[model samples]
Target: MRKIKLKSISIAIVLIALMLGSCSDEILVEEPRGVFTPDFFTTELGVQGGLTYLYQSTRSIYGFAYFLNLGETGTDEYAAAQSADNNFHDLDLAGQGNLSSTSGFSIGRVWGTSFPAINTASGIIENAEAVNLDNSLIAEAKFFRAFYYFLLVQTYGGVPLDLGGGELKFNNSVVRTSVRNTVPEVYTKAIFPDLEDAVNDLPDNPRLTGTVTKNVARLFLAKAYLTYGWWLENPNSIPTYPEASRTDPDGNSPSYYFQGAYDVAMDGINNPGPYRLLDCFYDVHVATNDRHEEMLFYSDRTEESQIYNEADLGWSGTDGGGPNTAVWMVTPNYTTITVDGVSAVQREAAQSYGRPWTRMAPTINVFTETFAEKDLDSRYDATFVSSYRGNWDKGGDTTPTITAANGMEIAPGDAVISFLDDYDPSVNYVNGGNLGGGEIAGRSDYVINLNEINRRFYPGLWKLGTYRTDNAGGLGSPNGALTRPFPIAKFSELYLVAAEAAVKGASGSMSARDLVNVIRARAGKWCYDNGENEPRVEDNSAAMVAATPAVVDIDFILAERSREYFGEGYRWYDLVRTQKWTEYASSYEIGGNSASDHSPTVTNRTIQPYHYLRPIPRSQIDDMDMSQAEKDAYQNPGYQ
Candidate 1:
């Protein structure tokens, strides 16, 4: 776990840039002050600044990862601020025939940013060697270059392999690279080589204490391989081009690429990298800092002992989180969460200031039935709640005032639902608020389904639904509510990914029992009979809450993943990867806000192959200069 020394690195980069550029007459004569030219930035010091820029790119909030949350066919975060009136009404959840190509929010951004990073990395790879650079530093840049490409291929399928680095000739025309490498070829030629080289050149430990290290590179490799395995194993259903004239000369199809992806994953994991899964989800807390085993590789947020104050906090506004009003509004009312050990109720006041983005809400189809069993897993509790003992607390109650990004005030209110008694039905209604009332109240409709006594409110409460006085006023005013809560990151996901890979690797022949049980054991609760009765499986009913000590299976693992990784953003991907998009929402009859409610019958069965890969963005098609039919054949062949 290398730590980044921000202050020292910052100073070193500037000084090095100056020293290296000091002899440049052009720089001295042209502006005497401004630094320019390759000569001025060719040294280690100059490279540090460039490297810092690369590091900063990894931490951006608007890339594929962030937009993935919104575009995934589950929750509709766009509808929260009342902004989703036109384009996204149908994206609430994936229904039969409900798929659309318009929601590819970050696809274009991913395409653009990845190339800049690729060029930056290529520059480092080429020039660093000329300067006799440290092998470790060079390895870091190569790893990033590969990482960017990995993202590109995964989302856009075969891409133009830009191996020429950044030295394009002045007369070079910008032509689409004709050799659109297959997914397998890309991994073998670009990703794997870069990672292997990185592992060899990079030190096991980084020179800076908290920067990207050998282990981080290894993790990136692991992810690349894992995703490659996924793509290889689950290739495109119908070939993008079926006719001889339509197919590329390489004869590669979607399925061929996906299978290669899986093989890459096996290679990465078998390498015995330093990263390992954390045994205890709750105890492995590295609040405000990076975790060693839990996060195999991550961009460091800490600066000069102060964790980079970036807002990665999923929900809630305090604990230095950003505005996340979506979760605050949609979480069911009866589902009470505790912060630390205290009732999340107590800390509602402080979550208002710097309220997290209310973006990214949970789909009722996916999240409501979660944690239905009383003896449900503790990991689920830790993953979603700020606290567990009938409240939300993390150390002492350090609840802060909730405020909007615009510096306006807001208040945190009571839990949308109260679980004080045995899953009481009335908690939902009682927790529902009048959205058209106070200064803060007027901002929301606070819609409630009066028909169902135990239903989650529409536009669910943000930041775990813990109420606070500070947010009693309107959003963004000083009088806002303080509703910050803990964000879930490295909890059960490692287990889930491991479980998924194991199950898929079985290829439906081998049983993946161990993988599932390991998760259930951590789930840590089971249904039990009363003192008069024995704890038998048949004796348990939906009302009976107890811990689960049963053997794990594939079906049960999916359910466990739902319960454990609810708000942390795993459900959508899980469903897509398993080819079970319909099942994600269709498994449960209920739709909308009520637990007892159900949508009109809609056919939701096994995933259509086209559903696996989103339609290439419409903008991408418009970007091409080819004929209408040729462009259609290339980007949207089915339509062609």
Candidate 2:
């Protein structure tokens, strides 16, 4: 595990510019008393500052911001959590039509933001070498630059491979790279080389300071290779109207970039890197505790990565506030599942699917399908809560009265237990039991029931703000307040990714069942042997069941992904890669309503092939100097 305390690179840059006047008096070669230009910060400190700037951008990687926004919307992740106000609306109403033809909203923002980041990284890399900064720091900057460019290639096709450093000032008239480079070309040309150098130069440990470590480099390298390969080899995952497939309507078959996607991705995975999946059981809780892990390449913190808070539930807070329910419905609840028939309580239970303006609750269909899997392997219980409700095991106040933060005694009136009985009865909201019918404070249209309760997570509401601690001196919850329980990252995913890479790369015959068994072993559970076609479940007590490896397949891995990482924010991507988008859409619905089906994050619902890769931003299209046919082909259908 590595930890790097990053500097505020942007702030440092501004300070340097202010001190260094642009207009230089040629009289004296060495400028005035306190002036410093690109040459001044080009020192070790300056390079370090620059590296930090690249990471600062990572803070924007959540549901509403950037990372998941593009990935979640218009994809299975988007479709999985579609709601009226979340990402689905943007995709449905704004991004409805063709990929090459439409200018969608977020699509444009991503394009604009990505390049600035690329240039920032490029600036650091260029400046570091000019001043001869420490080799390690230079490697860190290079890794960051490569990371951004990789994203650009993946998202916008052949983005201008700007190695221009700080020399090029910001300008809107920037041209798209002469032609889109193939994914393979971009990887070989940029990503692989940088990472190879990075692994050599970066430190072995986190050092509790902000700097790219060997682990981070290794993780990114692995991810880049895994994804590029997966995207390329699979025909369905590849964009249908690939940048290569389109022509000037003159019938010219443009070059495709899939090979690059494959090779570099393969390199990252098989390279003699020290990175490997940290054993999930031992490492999962530890990773969350210190934000330390060999697999996590980046994490975001806006002055603070708040601990889990239990009070907040609905979505009505600051921007980048909590997990957007719209894109997080697929995450499993940690509290309700059992070990050998005894509930394996979630001691560190925080919000998995976050608060919501648009509640992206799992559909009865998703729940049903999940249940069906549980029927096959009771181990799937580790994926979802066995019951949506739990007992209110309050230490002091056993009577059911919840205290407010302001020391106000609030008694929930006539609250109906809003959960299915078999789950848990003590804590659920019941009709007219307390809090006056549990009527959503303002809206009375929807009643208090299992759906709404489950939408909010039945047992307890968690947030980044609330963290529970048994002792006053403890690291588990620095604040000791109840915050959202969002597992921004998890260990189970590493196993799954490894499984995908192994299967696709043909690196090894690591069966999906073997990988799954490893994950279950960590979670203190195991898949049962039902011995039937309909996927039957055999009860295995803490004492009895023997571990037997089953045949691993894509479908099994997918089910595992859905169960384990649902709301942690990668379900939709898994669905798309596995071509389960339409199948999932046909089954799930809006805010837990089965019949009122809608797009996952976007509004209108339709799964078109062109949508696999989002439409290039509408604004970008208008700015492009392409031919009419090219422009027509790229126009945004959903843009208003």
Candidate 3:
């Protein structure tokens, strides 16, 4: 998961870059302009250089902006802080909102970033045969290609399957051969085969955060099978998606997919070594403890050890180690800077939670529905930062207009943001949280109703915004360079996957409730209610069943996933897979403040079934080698 420095890999990229491949079409250079060529890859440095480029692809797929837009914001899990014009917010409008393929934030980035990475991986996989390198490196290349294609399939079903390689084999000729492969074909032909080969080549257990190990491969393979059961049409479940299956090149039975998922999940669950869930859910994140046993794969920020900026990697966001993530997820401006009556000094840009865009706020559903048993759940406190006390000195202001005067003194107990589901209007507004200096007064200002808060000035999730006491919050100003690595995969997901698959078939020694209860036990023990380390529910299978959507089924799994991976970018995909995007969305209203002042929020939001898979980029279809008729055939169910 550690990034391969772009500088170290630029030499190889130059050779590839000389071709100037288009996002929609593979218009590679027929002639070479650099020493880094197909022949160069036969050497050790060339192979390493190519592998480095492959590593760079993880940024866009796992970066902060990409994660926020695709996973959390697209679903009901979060709302972007910006106004309606923000591209990420449009995705949340999937049913009736503007979510077109041409939207730069939605389709273009997903299509644009993935294809190039797939092409890079193809080069390494095809050319590695000419060189004498470790087969593990070649396995790593396949893992990346499979991983990227999976992302594509999940978003845009049946994308053009490109697997060209070598100097002339896959280079210039690929565009002519690239046609939209069927969703099932893409899974069986490209994605699955790659991972199967990769599992054989990679080691059973790898400790490095960046390496492709057998466990992640097993996890992904299981995920693919699960996706196949859900999307490609499962046999056990009714085949409701007529159009998707009619186009299925491989008419594999539903059991073929689900059973495959079940087997791989079991492999991952029974993985050798001490790979277990961490006691505290909060410990799963944070840079210092990044390589914990719970993590299977993560995107590492390389700014501290590497020479580069985010743009060079073709990403929308910068490194996590610096200020990229902090700016997006933290409060843009300090909400509680004074305690009773006191002043803080001029603030440094580094001391900011971030230029509080409030782009992604957890939905009212999170504070209310998800945490109905708030007293029993420790994850609520672990995940959200309710308030901030300006404990650090605001050294100086980088932006003079927003000056930090004297001592920015909010006492430890002072509330910056106290999320309250229950609204008491008398003290709720006008003078919000009466923690006075006349700025953000009364409970109404500092602590707003979950359903009434503005998206931009929303309650913050601590996962994205780090309070770095290291540089007195942070150093200098915010830039694209990252300070923390973004996680892409975690071992905790295996438990959920196992639970879901078991429920789908109800065929294992461990019941669905059995698997879910194990995770709940961990969440309870880590409760922030003082030193309360107790299980909220013992092996209470009967109770767990009653609390489910169908008293033990896919909906139950989806609910658990919401609690586990809320802002981590798995929400949208989960909604789509369960076919519950619209159903679940309809249950929550967009407004909070009683019935009068809730934002249109998600109520105006619509999710037609066709929106399950994103529209194939109009640009991608235009660039394909096929005729209009063939291209039309390639598009997923609901787009022009």
Candidate 4:
């Protein structure tokens, strides 16, 4: 995939404006020397520069591993892996660590990085028209402003609309006192209006490959309306920050918003411009096909240029905030799989096998339940790396051949370890053995039954795994940041969104089941089998559509979303919006964190009502010029 290198520009104004909360008692103020003022955006170059910076800032949140943890670790789709640190454990909501105001899960990335980007967007929006900038260019600014605010509202209930100046104004000066608007105010005043305008103004086709367009705007607008409807419903009685009534400022009912969400999403689906679902699920995520038409928006990365990628292409060690390393968290240490006392499956920077942090693992239900129809639904195969093939020669191991399970000699490129599609009672499990797998009769591969998968040894997320073209037949840059674009939105999700709205009592020509069947039918077609590591052609769309329940509900739609978008960082928000987090993920089963531990243990999480929203970053509170009581009140309900 060719990398689109956006024009680089200095965003000194945004950086300095974000220091508003950092003022001290005895402030030593100085005249700005090298800073660009908001007036700069009135010029043509400055407007273009501001727009470029807005796109650049997305790397801080979307593909960063820590930010992924905030979105997935505590939810049903993932759990803290055996080797996880406090950063992962704190978000787990288990006993490993407390998710306090001081937690280091990088929730503040959404808070800190977003405000500056919002300010930058505001500068462009306020000044672009003065320079005769095209309406489309100004619409980009509006889209970004609404985008950041949507993220802010979802993460922390109601963030400050007024950064330092008035609401949504460009602030060139630093001020310390900040007050958060209510949730209703944020949606009605900022997110809704800006997105609506953007949907109207953005072109049907993108000016640049990855730039926002009218359909992108419509998707976000539909999502915002759907999410706001849920907030108004508040069926779970989850409390909001700043304690406001769960009513729309415009006095619209929840049904009104739900119907609106359905209408907008269907409009996008019907009039899809330059966006459509790929032929199959595998095509959507395969590294070779990164940034395909199905992806509506994504954070771009490239192996072609280190500068454009924003991180070293050769090696990036555990750095967060800008690299596409979130996939590493879900990757297992496949290099540990040995045959005849020789490491068989060597770690390489291939999409099937990459550097493994083992910081997050899939829940057991991911195998037994969510993907129950592994044969009919090709998504299971498309999503995970279930087979570990021998690549000892790639690591300079000249053993030529090694004795594997069943006393069989296996060569390079053969299956060294395979997570079986079905459990076999006849397989002899190696309990307390050095090898963490069982030997199936007549099979040369070390096999792990569906029941034997654990935290330390499970399928790696292949969909977002590393892909590098510079391996040169060796373990190339296994520890480096992934060069594939981390997907943020896809065209397939439009069907899910419209279906979800229909379930929420929206009137639509397509019923809830009809919309869901659209997704399920696509899922049943297979072009490549990830486990077999070969091509396979099959079409079971008929069976897939036939199996759909006549009446689909919210739970069914949530399950479908999980199957489609698992491990891409969509779980927590989906659950939170539907108020199903605690009900669906409060308890899960996984084996102990040891090679010999094969017994599944049920672990429980203390998901509180206040956990619906994360705590405000402690640093943000400390920097504020408010009294102790005021600071406490500014925080979300539970954290203080």
Candidate 5:
């Protein structure tokens, strides 16, 4: 995998504008400046460019690869394939016994990208009055600044605070070494204040999907408050800083922010804004429906907004990463075999599901119970691809010839999986009976169960696959390039957030189960009443959890989130904030599927108290030049 480099960025030169007189009226026109300078911010274009860069900086944060590594993998919902190379490969287990520390490379990317963005946003905020544009632009800048800071502070508790643009010189001087702020101070001084003002300043509706809106700021603000509230209750956190809840300015109990989080989430839910859950859940991820009501904000990947060029195959000049989708979520590397006289060569993921490096796999927690129910939950079938076209050729030709040796012509939507070889190693001696009795004994039903998919042929999450696009011209089609938009905040999550806040003592117009029941009922709303609603004759128990019961709680909500937001990159944060890492989480064998010889079953994943926060990058610790005492004081609490 390619790594993104983190290098310090200096605010570059002033844009020089040339004045020219118009021929007709002798009107004076102010030309735009090429270089960026402190004075240029006084002009409209400079402020716009600065704000644009602030959003662009985040492209790396939501990149398919980055989010998988940072946010999703090694959690209860998902795990990486067993590539057997480095400590990073298996996130669920520790390299030896301890969870892995932040790689300097990844941490550098975090510090290097986010801090500079903060500096730029600060530069914009400080110069807001000087600029002639609307305060909204400056307000947008504040949101981004708070946004970057919040991400950093959550990962590495109380990072060094540098808000303004320009140089901050550091020497070996003891007093000169910047002292880190308390966790509360970082929020109150930096994250809270900025987002508070931003919510007031930004408009209710943003001009673009990627741009921040008032509702957007409030959503994050609620999340920040919730995080702060939860941290107060954590016993393993807060190394030396004074307990925040004891001296909180709010004068409320420790969970004050929980209420605050709940309140803001309600405001968002009740707000008569454009954001709402789409009726058809499948429409949420398709390219054409990118403008749906579910989108609160998304990382822009269209040609118009692509800042990092994926088209630059050479990866020259700029730190290149193309506009991307979350295709890396559930694709497995599978070769082809002829079954039932139908020959389907395994297609390139880029063509079908988009190139999957087999980065991560959906665990049994998701498959069996979380996303169970073939007849009730339409999401199960809508999200996974059980069939692929066997073009019988890959010579760059528009059409490939298929013969009887290639078997019957399988439609694009035909069954891709057909065997239920569970290969439990313990139970399997050679006999078969796991299938649905008629569809091939123990054969995986691509629609209801994943029995057809063996170790190598893991059922690919059809959500990320652009398989819908393959219909027009087939595998070698000209359209549906792998690079697509990745959803960051969906209105659906806001509903879940509202449900959680209500459970945690926020205002709840509806019960937690009622709120979650909306999602559960919606999952089954699209499916037709078929015999598969319940388990089949031979099928012992596949849809046990798939039954839509009205029972609900925090555990129920979290499970539903696993089902709904699986691989959308929210698992790790969910586990951390709730402190439920050990409750029901499971370990698994990765790399290949259950049948693969290469796959190894890994167990005893350690989710410890120290892991509540990630260590600051070693590079930053070295750069700070702190003594043993100072280092202990400055670094995150539990790291070496």
Candidate 6:
């Protein structure tokens, strides 16, 4: 872990200026420098500025590509793409590279950034009481502290609660000596208490948009309970770090935590404050509707103010710090697609098309099995870009009309490439023509059947794609970092949490199937047809609710989670919490990386028992003031 030092007072000044500047059209540029004094945080300005910095710190993890790779690459939802580097291959566990303490995996970001934020939160919390700051403001600090610890415990097993001074103390001096806390100790002492206090002290509504609220605290507290319940059960016998027992320190059984999770989730659902599910599933992900009521908390980003955005709105060459570029990893290279030997889909700074790095691709089972009900479920259409339209004019290619796949004349805005919703045997396949797969007989666009999807030519992630308001009449900056906010928590997940807990034998008023039916019913509503590119008014609620199984299981809930939250950096945590990573992701089928290789390749991942907790980052181990033996012992079992 990097040394946690006191942030200079100038950071607060610069952040406050940016916050104030966001209200106007002017952009402010300022350099932050100065040392911290004991009296700094006692003032109201210091406390508020520290709080703002805490919210901004999330950008280092949430929208970053490296951290996204750690969360999604090793799981069943995605695998290394054709152009993936060692940063991706190391985590795939497919013999491309080894995931060791020395590997370049970005798990270190969670460790390195969280501690400093925790210390900052600690500083605000400790001094705010002295200054008689409102409890709600202090509650925000508590919420952030717990949030970072929750992320840490999940990623690195157990981390240091005491940084230099004491447990949860605000230390201004640098400290290299550290001790790992037990998972139970970390949860019982830090996470649970802080979140419980936050739920009590936080306001019903946020004072600022995207700030923590009572419901956000409740959501996380319930999720923490659910995850702890799974850890206590230890159903798969996965080993934990620091060699601790799988018992809650409070003497509660796993069922108690499960029951706790269900009750809390139900509370949030019953008394939702300015939060409720969006009517249609498509609305939840639409770029223009990003700040809708469904999102509980998110890492905020904007193209309106470059100062508040903390990165350039037009172009970004680096993925460091505040760039929201994780979407680039999953986007297919649509600009290479052609129609009638002319480049058809030019890259644009729109939600449908973005810069493509081709670092990760979805598994074939994602289309064939997990989302088999593509037509009835609007989520599949909302989640992916299945059609590439001709925008050659935007790229200055003035070929007004050209003969397409079926010798049909096509103009601009016509379909260039369309992925079939299901396999069509009548489609005539060309082995090496275009990128991959075949074309339909009478269609003007080239078509790739569902089974023929390859690494080079799969559906791009539409939900998390690029969005820019400044693209005026031409191809704008598709290479820029996505300016949309990356949602971290949503209100709809409460239903899933309640249902999962109910399935785990937590007695509740709503049955497991009843709770799940709520989400299924929502999935059936559609206001927009993403594939057809038109408005659609349809409700298949009865059909969707009827399809639900009479009995719900963990596997069912996991599948629903994938359908609801695919490629959103939630897969690894979900799989690890349920101990389903090995069973579900042992093998996946996808075509070879080459443009012409459409044949499915069965790739097997070598997941082991100790791979559950990622190796302790080598930087953390090296920076600690400990002997070589102590460092070796501090590392996770397999890595050492």
Best by TM-score: 6
Clashes of 5: 24
Instruction: Kindly list the per-residue Cα lDDT of model 2 for residues 134-205, writing each as its tens digit.
Output: 677667767876776666665555444432211222222224322334455566667767877887797665
Please list the C-alpha lDDT of all candidates, in the order they appear: 0.40, 0.40, 0.56, 0.83, 0.54, 0.83
Q: Model 6, 409-519: lDDT tens per residue?
A: 878887777788988888776631266646676777777876767787789899988888888878898877888999899999999999999999998889889999999
Worst 10 residues of 3 by lDDT: 1-10
User: Where in model 3 is the C-alpha error above 4 Å?
Assistant: 1-36, 64-66, 80-84, 94-97, 163-169, 172-177, 234-252, 303-352, 395-413, 421-427, 433-446, 467-481, 527-551, 586-602, 621-640
Residue 133 accuracy (lDDT) in model 4: 78
Each candidate structure's TM-score, on Cα atoms with residue i matched to residue i, is: 0.61, 0.62, 0.78, 0.94, 0.78, 0.95
Model 1 alpha-carbon drift over 4 Å, by segment = 1-42, 61-71, 75-104, 163-179, 235-280, 283-293, 300-360, 365-370, 373-376, 385-498, 505-512, 515-565, 569-571, 582-608, 617-630, 636-640
Give a tens-digit lDDT track for model 4, residues 34-104: 45666777788677767766776788888887766989998888998889999999999989998988888
| lDDT, candidate 3, 10-100, per-residue tens | 2233222222222312321222223345565556666666665665556655654545666666566765544334466566673424766
**What TM-score would you give candidate 4 relative to the actual structure?**
0.94
**Candidate 5 global lDDT:** 0.54
Q: Which sections of candidate 6 miss by over 4 Å?
A: 1-38, 431-433
- Candidates' RMSD to native: 11.6, 11.6, 8.2, 7.2, 7.8, 3.0
Looking at candidate 4, the ten consecutive residues that score lowest on lDDT are 1-10
lDDT, model 6 = 0.83
Ranking by lDDT: 6, 4, 3, 5, 2, 1
Give the C-alpha miss distance for residue 375 in model 1, angstroms.
3.1
Residue 306 displacement (Å), model 4: 1.5
Worst 10 residues of 6 by lDDT: 5-14
